[model samples]
Target: MKQANSGALVVFGLVLIAGLGGALLARGALYLGMHEGDTLHLLDMALRMGLHGQWPHLDFMTPIGILAIAPIAGLVAMGLGIGTAILWAQVLVALVLLLPLVRMAGSRFGGLWSYVMLGYGVVLCLALVHGLANPAPSVSMHYNRWAWAIVYVVLPLALLPDRGRARPYLDGALIGLGVGALVLIKVTYAAALGPGILVALLVRREWRVLVVAVVAGCAVLAVMTALGGSGFWVAYLTDLLTVAQSETRPAPGGIDFADAVAGPANMPSSILALAVVVLLRMTGRKAEGLALLVLAPGLFYVTWQNFGNDPQWLLLLGAAVFALLRTDQPDSRHAGRLHDAMKIAGVAALALTASSAVNIAYSPIRHLFAEAGNTVPLLSALAGQDDIRVAEKRLYKVDAGVPLDGVGQPFAAYHDRADRKELSRLKGEVLPACELSTGYNAMFETIAADLEAQGHAGSAVLTADLLGSLWMFGDLKPLKGGAPWYYGGAPGLAAADLVVVPLCPTTEKSRATILAALEKSGWRFDELRRTDVYILLRPVRP
Candidate 1:
């Protein structure tokens, strides 16, 4: 017994180190590569709330959860730069979410195979971290991966037959917490998993466990709702309905079973294979059968929601491999064949993951670390100096030499080295503006200057192409309550003194609508400036 305890401790330490180390390494790599995208905007909004006590409106269209952004906000409030704050927050989250799984795996497998299971967990963490930094079609920083990881961790424990007397309570609490967190992060995802978990509990007839889980989950929801206020509920429900009704938004669709079973990553095929293994095990192993049965509904939900890009499928693959590898009766012919098939599927999944990683070689871990040795010092030097005007002037001078792309350009491509002079320039002048500009520094500055010259700097400016840039660069507030898209059919058009619409192929319809509205309102329109990208417009005198 003493030896078993010691072995568990050793494995725990190793797994903790690997998981935490991998997370931090991934964070550092992403930071060095200057990889910022969708999530950063969410973080920015959270930071504003935390730092300035400015909460987003209840009707705000974006659907990010408050809990996911809160930690980043907390980190930033503690005087960490945004990059450093995000790094630490992500690492902490990864550890919190993964450590329980390691403990459970070690407790169940209890040997070298236990170590392999923990290693598998570490790889998944690394894969998620990689996705966060360099998002691809198959892997990205989305809620689904995290939700599925929790599912993978909880389902095994839920299915284990010999969890002892106290384990049901503990497992129930853990599931409650995990699912609660997922619920706060994404309610729709929570809705998907909830039915499966409830049905599983009912099948097992674990009334006490079900009660504990339900109570704990409700408590979490109540607390979060209290903190977020009543407005948050309104916002959440509104967003949910809006997303469901909107044709532009991606909605969950029915899964093609044949396609899933023959998918390239072997995820779907492995799941089907695992189902067969579970049935075979039922002949002699009731515990394994029950476990698979409990896990089946959630797994099916994940497979159905698999839109070919989500990394959640990998979690399913990992779970199947773990089950196959750990199943006893290795000498049985059926078991041996099942094990072999699982091995092949596991190898295929690993290969596909490796291929995806290689395809994003631009943000390789080694390169990021090596480059960080140069960039970190510069980042340090620029810290603690927050002067917006100096940064704006520098941004105005630093041109990209080409017109701005709607999607921001990569910062690394623009500034390769953090030489002392370059660092000083960034620190004393441009860094503040660069942070806000998001690769649109030069263009935003030009537009802002033109707006100022035309006496419309502080006006509620309506922009077609430059959405956030109007406020971020030109000190112009958006004319409408929501995003620019809302302004297309918005009631008050004549209220806006200046309207800047890019006369491009993409904006032709919107531009025509604005023109028609202007003509209808008896407000004469004159072109203020015509650039290759935008046609700035202003109202003529009545």
Candidate 2:
């Protein structure tokens, strides 16, 4: 009892320090702007879903995040400005949802291992880091990330070493529902730690409990499908398949072996630690112990799936510790050593988390400093050149590993180190193109096109990209101002008297197709100077 109490105190201290440090760093430096790519597009869809009282799903090709995720993010944005509120909200939510899992584990394991599991697990670690720095931290994208932690990671720990008096089936079902909810939010999450949960449940011989969970999940899904239409099923399947492809498919930025090995190594030492527990379980050690051996693999698989060292990985550690803590056998002499080992691990995990928090907090500033330091010296040396523009031109021409070149040009590309290399490769390549007249795009373009089709052509025509600068265009504003759905399709092409596209090959294909369609409809293309983006024109109808 004395050792357990001591372990609890140490564990609490470490988690507190890690959590507090992460929260403070995230609050200070990270800005909340959505870029033009994945995060922006996902949030844009979420906003529309919230406004219209429609839940987004991946039907046909429309991208819709999970149900709980989108609304939570949309509500947060509504209450606080979208950019500033999102990052904080994500961290708070991850903590709120995860702390319970840790406490539950502590209740079962003794405080020592529960703390280590919660603190050092890959899911929790990754999420804490990701929450602090990632540009978009809306629950929409990261919701499943957390769900995986709770369902596969934490819930399994909770189930093992059951006290016999507790509500096992109900608890398991609720945990399953949480996982199901994650699947609904982002189809990508359907695979995230799901198989692991199944494996754990089976090993525990909780087959009846599993049945209850499945039934409850099926019932909820049925209700949703009935209310939402066939589009719901179609979208769900589409999202699931797409997510599977993305995970399994090789991309330039796919798997990194070093990240895999280094991430989970600190917490657990050997298969022996796990092996002893399993042997004891089968050798009448503890029922919970035997169940845990199966559960551990699921947790590892989930953590391994997220190769980028995201903060969500911490939850996996939390789950593992929870499992360990629950296995405390009072008669075993090794309990004292286990308690001491866990305390040391907890302390070390806390220190690592603190360092991680600092690294994430200063990442942007570090990048900015590195870029500025190099540029300042060269500018000073070139200060005396007669043609300042010439010096500037020369400086701009230097390949900065970005698509945008030339000094003083509008819409100059900001090179993001994270995606620049891959994005540059994708620049000229034709993608698996999204046609303008389908899914959400269809809905958006239809509304915009209706305005033009009904002789509202004189209204200011604009695309989603120009939404922020709506005031700059003309007196005419979007029927649904700043709604991104209408930004890319036939509506975006036809609503405006002028069109401008980037000069990249992808843009060229889109621009060419759009222009050809417009000319076929008797509209004339008045070519405007096109750079990386686009510019096109048509005569006023008399």
Candidate 3:
């Protein structure tokens, strides 16, 4: 027991040091204005909640979606601040999850279990960092990210042994609830964990747990339905069902689809493959764990693909691997030699785990190295304490308006009292309609055209990132500070007397044809702007 406590201490210490180090590094970058994706969105949601007393979707004033990054937001609200809280939240969730797995491994294999947890932690943190960089808005924003993090912790606890059987039912119920929370958080990994969840259920064969999970899941869904409205729930359910109908979808433009297999998923998928081995070699209930371990990833991979092999998904994946590799039979005479082999394997696993740690740790190290890149201007931008005149230039693009395209909200920072205050006061759910009336920028012309074709011309258009396509192509009149479409200020499409739309003809012939079309429409064809993107306008009063 003393030794076990010692081992736990060592692991705990390492985790703390590593987590703090990682947080400090990230905080520095954040402080220096090195903002990543979802950073803005998450902060926006928090500011809306904090400054405005809103609860994610309940705060309809801000045309943003739900505060899916709730855990982070809650931490931030509690005064832990933003970036540090987010990083620590990820680490803490990972540690809570590792507890059960370590216990299970120790129950069967002893000290080696710690090593396995350690290794898995490394892999998960590494993968999480990758996702952290350009966190998909839903995935990283508010409660959504936290919910996924909880899923990472909860699912592993469920699969681990119920040590003393105290609350196998509770554990199972918690797993279900966590999973249910995840499903509601965002449909991001709903598809990826199918095989994994199945494997866990089949392995545990605890129907009560499943019932608890179902009930918990239903309760969460019911609450969301009640709060978000039946129509919203219907749409949410429909979107989930639609995505599930297809096993794999095309990767977004820049994201790499291939990374799905190389990361932590390898662990779960490997276990599934090993389950075949276990079923063939082991006997009775003893073999059930291994078999289920193997089965889960296989089933999950087929059912949900978005997990895209993210490292965090490996929480159970690592446990399954350890389960499969564990030998149930006693060693007898070769026990000493076998112990040595186990020790060696444990060490090797720790080393492998260190690789994961390094992967996660690498971000901070890189950021440290990039520290030199922080100039007076960047630091000023980050501190939110820059010289007003210089800071104004960096924060508000003279050319780009308050809300840039693709970056859905207006005001680079939600601190833009004039805009965000009104946005946060909204009474109910708000979905920013992406339509042509927002204005024509090079970045969203295709999207704008689609909206127009769908008869949504007068709807507001917002993009996640203004690709600077609008400025190069369109004759869009400047709105307030920057280009028209970029600011958070809602272009009162209802009130606009005139609006411009641009189309870029790549080839000379195509350009002539487009010009001809414009001429035929009886609208004047004027080459008012020149760039890679083209802009056209229509008089609203006409």
Candidate 4:
């Protein structure tokens, strides 16, 4: 008993070191490799929530739950530099989750498996980059990483029986807090795995676990409600429905639901899961088999819902498959085959997910080297802080897009042959058939400076761009009730004094979508001015 306890402590100690050391390796700075737009979106929301004391859903609009940005916002509110706040917030989150991780990992796993499970949680918490093995580092969809970490901590406790003693209270409470955190971080995760967790506990007759998890989850909800109010939930649901119903909000990189499940990239893990489910049932591990049967679709759903469609669940699935092997009966002749098959499946699953796992674990090490490139500060608003920097080319290089043939060309008959979506129109005004790419920080800072120079400083501006982050760049006041990223609707129109319409947007369809929604909502506006940069309009009382 002493040896095992000490082993768990050693594994946890390694996890703590890996987490804190990795974060501190950045030297209190955050260097981003890609996804400046997404980073700007996060910073905009954090400043709004922190400096302006805005509440998500109440004072602004976003599908992302407040908890996703609140910790960083709180730190920024305390006058911490944004990049420093991000790194330390990660450290804070790791420390906060350490106990839950200890309870879950210590109770359920033994040997190296404990390290794999808990270390992965630390990686999810502390990694500077969001997962996609080969891609450059980014903080984009970081909440998804956090949500997956919570899922890791929860599902293990829910599915696996304890190694030493079954303390249902500790397990259930942790599971509850995890799921609750998932809901508050990214609702898609909870919506994905919450049912499977409940059923797994039910099938195992772990009534205490189930009841306590429900109570704990509700306790989290109650606390959030007491802090924000019931309307917060309604607004959260509204934001979710907006995304669910919007055609533009599908999984990015053109990955649809079927693609997430059966696409070339996902096929291996999907096959491994199916084979393992069959093997688990064949080996008389019916409860776990049923759980996986239910879990596979949920995993696919979350992958499809997330921006990158990363199959991060594969590692956990692989871990669970290996763990299930220990539960098999020794008498069956097929036990040998089941063990062999589980081993192969588990190993293959891990192999498939290995690149991304390694990528996540190696992010901070990569961050240290990211400074080798010619870099510039991420935002001029936080300029001179020098804590957040990006590659020079990613900011200065702009891609405004190439148009198809004009009136007298070969493809002229095709008429604006772009991608899948058509060029958008707003209130009978056709937007240009072009899109902006890269140069997010440069673009926002330039436009914000121009607006300030034109005597619009401190004015609340609503931008008909993919992100409403003009406030992040200059003296403009943060939109009191606007979305940082447009997920549809005229989100902050009520608080917007001027609407700035970009001719060439980073995401043309999204820009068109927002403009159309604002027009459709009957927002009365008078065209104030037009420039090479943008068309400005002032909202008028109808």
**Tens digit of lDDT per residue, candidate 2, span 56-163?**
543112334445345445654465433333344444544554544544444444434555444432233233223334533222234434454455334544355443
Ranking by lDDT: 4, 1, 2, 3
Give the poorly placed runs of model 2, Cα more than 4 Å off.
Answer: 1-39, 52-55, 58-64, 73-109, 112-141, 152-154, 157-159, 188-190, 243-253, 256-307, 311-500, 504-542
Task: For candidate 3, write residues 36-101 as lDDT tens digits.
Answer: 223343444443354335554332222222434555556666766454555555555555545543
Q: How close is every model to the real structure, measured as TM-score?
A: 0.66, 0.54, 0.53, 0.94
Worst 10 residues of 2 by lDDT: 381-390
Query: Which pairs, if any, clash in model 4?
Result: none
Residue 133 C-alpha lDDT in model 1: 28
- Which structure is stronger by TM-score: 3 or 4? 4
Check candidate 1 and list the clashing pairs. none
Per model, how many backbone clashes are there?
0, 46, 44, 0
Ranking of models by TM-score: 4, 1, 2, 3
- On lDDT, the candidate that comes out on top is 4
List runs of model 3 lying over 4 Å from the truth. Answer: 1-22, 25-67, 72-112, 115-128, 131-152, 163-165, 188-199, 238-249, 252-357, 361-372, 375-542
For residue 68, model 3's alpha carbon misses the true position, in angstroms, by 3.8
Cα lDDT, model 1, residue 493 = 48
